[model samples]
Target: MKGRGFIFAFLPLLLTTCIDPFDIGDVVNGQPRLVVDGLLTNQPQAHEVRISYSSPTLNTFDREVVSGADVFIEDENGSQVSLIEDTEREGVYLTPSNFAGTVGVTYTLRVRTAENVSYRSLPEMMRPVAEIDSIYAELDSRQSLSSLGTLLNNWGMQFYVSTGTGTPESNFYQWKWEETYQFTAPLAREDQIIQPICYQSGRQFNQLLIGSSQDFSQDRIGRQPITFVSKNTYKLQQRYSLLVKQLSLSERAFNFWSDVEVQRDTDGSLFDPPPSQIIGNMVRDDDPEDIVLGYFQVSAVTEQRFFITRAEVPASPGGPIGGFSSCVESSEPPADGNNGESSGGPDDGPPDFCYDCTLIQGTTTERPSFW
Candidate 1:
């Protein structure tokens, strides 16, 4: 997954509601606000909490990292575990590898900054998440505005998830996904001993994906559309693997993310509702009135992996997309047919990736274990 730059985005939402006059200059020169983003799940892994201060929306500086802070999580049973800060990542703190949140156990996150300003989160209980019964994809199309101000039909794949009902008390859910796809270079050949196959992987960022079974009469979610991949992109060019993680959220957590989604989806139209102050669960012990900016989440997570091949998706009506259109070969091969560089001259040759596939970004020749 990408870095949570969303923390920075949350700043404007808070500033607009908390500050007077709504002046841009005031925010540009205002004090940095503390942000706490942490999550604990049922999976036994080294969970992490990210601590940073929000950078001014108009500032050129990066997000402010609150390093050398003391961070920990305590359970309702009075057991506590200290999190170790990552030396390389500054403000990020990680729990022990064996540490995992158990269902029904309430957990609270605490932080003490280097400045001695302490903050604590309201206790959040880990709730049980439903297992994904199945994952499927189907051909779909969406109309989008073109640069010429005309509607253009963009064809793509829509991925859906069907899951059994969760515990009655835990029906709110959020879904996150990471995708890995396999692609081959256009000019690769076995006889010439070139590594053609490669893989690229990434996760959806910036977008909030959440659903509630309470919205439905059945109290169960079926075929919920978690994400969509447009056929115009390279992701569907070859074999693709998507791993979807489902997390259970409390009603409060669900409402919090829903508000975030509302703010994110607003296109800055006159009819859009003004962004409101999103009060997180954290409160500063040193100053009760300070507004902390992020959420500390506790959830029971379940996951499922789905795979698809190029042949599975029908061809786009507009024609083949995602091909290496830029990888054009010269009429004549290299002088010795070995350098893989243009005959014009090694220094004057086209991009390195035109001849070798591995040089492409986000691609690796090594096959994934799951693949």
Candidate 2:
């Protein structure tokens, strides 16, 4: 960042950076603020709105729960639905399965913490979403160099969604994907397979996609890529299924997400606006200037699901990579000698990490209902 090649004063003019106004170190000096995250959807069954508190600019995921509060949502018709805290989950408030928002209706959330602090969201009208015309998969391949300096061949499938939007007012949309795949792990004891099958499901993370049709002429997003799977990984080794949720966002919600996209894309240069705190419709009723992080909105959602098997990618020039993860299986007995081994007492077995696939985050032995 130094030297004569680029002027020091012009550094901000070249490229922008993505950092909140406060450095991470300021977290200890800053006051904790409320983080409101969730949405009211038309298809909602026991919908949840999470309330937690955390100061900004820290690299920690620990957020204190704002619990023991009265939470409820009021519809434009003046009907109020109370939310009860989930005894099983901290900071999560849930509504009845029958409680679902309706399209074209505005809803506002109100919360009064046990500490007597009150916060509310501006009434957000439930927007309308375009239905997905179709979802298709395309087998693709690419080459790259591995860290081991070897040529790598990768194959995968790219999933896309098609939409038909003839209306002009419905110009903003958001997308999120949930993928579940079956992984079979062969657990062996002493050379013979003890558990030949282990089924686990996983959900995709950080697959963010947003589109605004304001610029295009009447035509909505035709073919938008949702997610891709690299064949080199174990995800595509067996059967895989994906769920795509298309959400209709109000112009305000669209703009909020757009700013998030911009801040994520910038490098803190003059070309980009200086990084500032991004807050949504949630505000404190007690203090007007108090900054609350996160947003609450009502959205109409349409979802589509796609299923694919290894046989679908026929052109890929390789055999299936079984989902078995590489790990050191010891023939020795456990240090505690309490583990139930075979009659001989000391049989070779896979480690708990590999044997119990649930060790992986977000994995469950209970298969998804759709699968």
Candidate 3:
């Protein structure tokens, strides 16, 4: 036989060139992914759940603080609940301080990872929408929290919902706004209190302005406007509870924040000069007049479009009338009206107040009252 067919074609090419140290790099390693975002709205007693991850190296060692992972919750006759890990804020996974999620029940989420890596989330069903047609307060002189300071005081609150009718397009609606402030006393120290300023995304009517007035170019105020009603006016409040879930597609984790290095004094002559602190977690305040500084927490998901009619008062372009009385005339000045003349007054020389109005180019040197 031709030497047994050349030993069966050289023994299958020597067993395919024998090499399997567990398939070496199995095509270049890198396999460990999981990201699950959870949200249930109707706002009131909204529980908590925030998980984050994604890393291959921004500096390596990516976030995995599931606080001892392994979380579970299932109900629909299977009855089960297990969720814990939120000691101040670690990887947030809390739910069971008197469990609340009953609108017809259907929930599931089991996650386990200590490197064992096993993640799942599939069943989330509960829908009951409609409740909240009253919560109003007005005195909004076009809203302001500190364009410079002092303008109608600052106040915001408007939430109205009295509508129902879905399944006409696979129904997917979400709205959550909760405000609970009960502090008559207890806080003269321990600063950092900026809660529930605003957050609206009732399915893409995007708006988030929490902690207003560090002056990114001031416009701050208790801004409000979220409307959509047509469920025969209103009536759905036995405490109100509407939950509908079934949306989880995890795996896209990459949270990076580290890019800040500002030091400016092109030549406005340092009046105090001392601001170059960039210690990560997302900090940026080279102080043009003050721009976004530390304290990280940002979330986004949008479709955008929210409408409400009625509030259109415009018709006053008539001629002059002098002596202030075009209806109690007043239309400008007051945003700190030039903040103490740019904070250096004692007759500071060479300050015709425009050394290019405080040059700041490279290392963010504060300038721009309107620069």
Candidate 4:
């Protein structure tokens, strides 16, 4: 089966089977509806796993707890690891220790319920993928807007992520990126500009996955040059994290009612069936940590630009308006393939680059950082 763009598209087919008279009432009360939400990518890390269940909605009074369910992880070497419940939380189980899943190792999961129903997942292998080397960000000038007689400038940052592996021709991998920003405003202030942004992309099957860069960009806000009084410097800090995961093509089907077998009485009466066979592809060597762990690699850079009243002012004691700090604290040359040049550096990187300005000795109280 072709991989769907969204994971939720599998819900409809997951709930119903091909059996005729699909009326859910034919099943016994309190039939279990299990949901497994985590699938690990080939990255080596520890990830969280969540399994939940709800009673058949059609049968109202059949609600029951899924407690006492046994969950375990199995590796390719026939090693089994048991999961324990979280002390601070209920109904959630976590691996006893962290495990970094390696490529070429197959993993599977086993779940045994209180009612003696069993479910297993097909063995999944972690596929090798590229890792991001660096990310570059620059101001986006196309999104400026004019409002209330003032040319309010909205700021946008474009990102370019470099990977060490070559692009693949087929077998698309899902990518997720998140950014966290911090403002100079007080921690209690709710109006800060920190927010989370995300984007998704995929690669096709049969394609050669090679080392290269993938472009993913997003506009921060609708408005530009956030209008504000001069002289006040706002500090903006941002950090980014990326996650890539390969999904399996085959899906496992399980019976909602699995424990008890149903039969017809001698008087032509029907007995309530037990939970439909809780069936799913048995995962032979499942590793809970790798399935949920997000391979985390982060890179950060910061710049401060100020708004000023006069375009041509005497050189201030602080520094140039568009200058940037050194990428590394030490004097060691930047790492190869690491493009750490600033807009205005020893060679004068870019002309339009302007750094935030401070209150100069002779300037007025209101000094603009960047226009």
Query: Where is the poorest 10-residue window by lDDT in model 3?
Result: 13-22
- Worst 10-residue lDDT window for candidate 1 reads 17-26
Model 3, C-alpha of 80: deviation from truth (Å): 14
TM-score of every model? Answer: 0.81, 0.75, 0.24, 0.41
Candidate 2 lDDT by residue in tens digits, 1-371: 11011010111110111111111111333566777766788985888888777644454354577889899999998999999999987788888878889999999999999989999998999987889888888876668788999987666777888774777554677676777777544343456455333244444333346676676666467668777677645566568888888888887877765555555556867888776556778899989788776677688999999888877766545445433433333433222111222222224345554454444444457766787
* Model 3 TM-score, all chains together: 0.24
Question: Number of clashes in model 1?
Answer: 0
Q: Write the per-residue lDDT of candidate 4 for residues 1-371, one digit (tens) a residue.
A: 12222221111112222111111222334354554433443333333344545344655234343467787767789898776666664455656445555565676776776766666665765544433344444344333345666555443333333333343322222223322221211122245354222111122221111111112122111111111111112212221221222222211210121110121111343554433323334322333322210011111111222222222221242222221222223222122121222344445422221121111112122312221
Residue range with the least summed lDDT across 10 consecutive positions in model 4: 292-301
In candidate 3, position 81 carries an lDDT of 68
Task: Give candidate 1 misplaced runs (Cα > 4 Å).
Answer: 1-31, 56-62, 145-149, 166-170, 188-191, 266-273, 316-318, 328-355
Predicted candidate 1 versus true structure: per-residue lDDT over 88-119, tens digit per residue: 88878999989999999999999999888899
Decide which is better by TM-score, 1 or 2: 1
Q: How much is the lDDT of residue 81 in candidate 2?
A: 96
Q: What does the lDDT read for residue 329 in candidate 4?
A: 33
Q: Return the lDDT, model 3, position 315.
A: 16
RMSD of 2: 8.7
lDDT of each residue in 134-189, candidate 3, tens digit only:
33322222344556666542222233322222223212222323221111111122
Q: Largest lDDT belongs to which candidate? A: 1
